[model samples]
Target: MITIPREIKEFIELQGIFAVGTTGVNNIPNISPRIFFRVDENVIYWLDFFKHKSYKNIQANPWVTISVFNKDDLKGFQFRGIVNFITDEPTKLEIKESIIKKTLEKNSSEKIKKLSEKIEVQVIRFEPKVCYSLNPDEFSDMCIGSDVDSTQLFQK
Candidate 1:
């Protein structure tokens, strides 16, 4: 797994939702907005509610790319990774606490607790293999943590 740099990690944290790309048995591409996302040390996780289309797609193909950006700044990042579906009591509780406490930073413990009880959540854990710049106009898909020659980085 590739380590996500602090800049990229902060970029991800600033965004509330992400567009996740996936393809199912027919091999057609799908991009769906995903919330309830959390980034741990080396892995990222998002929630799938009610077995959505993205969940079905991942069942057939685990490969996915998560994209988030700031329109005003024209800055973005795309994370390419494989997802593993998890549905366990402990994981759900951990997700609940992390998402509500850290990512959302919500102090409405009672309200969030009630909401968490109502929703049946399926966690999609992401293990990123590579990451790249979203500014193709400027960087030409410069990879953040790749093994490409340093000279390539100098071109821009």
Candidate 2:
């Protein structure tokens, strides 16, 4: 298990979209944009809407990576780890609450909001194993992997 840095968590909170990378056949990697996610400590959870190709890929391979860059400066962090899916009622209730909150914020149609809240969404829990700070100058700086060291936080 690895701990995600506070700086990285702050960066993630400000962004709405994050890209998740998963491996497919022949080790080909597939990246998809995720819209609904929240980071809690070292754990990240997201609503898996539609259960698309990426979902299928995760079923085949547990290893995955997430890339989140601030849209303003393109500076961000990459989180690598394995994922666990949550289909329980608690997760569903959380998703419903999130949807309702967003709907209220956006002031969208009540009927639409009602339908959205009813839609089944899979909750994905990710345990981060590694994280790398990204930038154009250094590219890879401030890395935290499985083994927590002086230079890094953890190393797998």
Tell me the lDDT of candidate 1.
0.75
Candidate 1 lDDT by residue in tens digits, 1-156:
777778777788877778999999998998998656788767888777657678889999898888988887888888777899776879777875677556446334565455555556787789886677887476745567643353443243
lDDT of each: 0.75, 0.73
Error of 1 at 40 (Å): 1.8
**Model 1: per-residue Cα lDDT at residue 88:** 81
Instruction: Give the least accurate 10-residue stretch of model 1, judged by summed lDDT.
Output: 147-156
Estimated TM-score for each candidate: 0.79, 0.76
Could you say which candidate leads in TM-score?
A: 1
**Alpha-carbon runs more than 4 Å astray in model 1:** 103-117, 146-156
Cα RMSD (Å) per model?
Answer: 5.6, 4.4
For candidate 2, the 10 contiguous residues with the lowest summed lDDT are: 147-156
Clashing pairs in 2: 145-154, 145-155, 146-154, 146-155, 146-156, 147-154, 147-155, 148-153, 148-154
Error of 1 at 52 (Å): 2.0
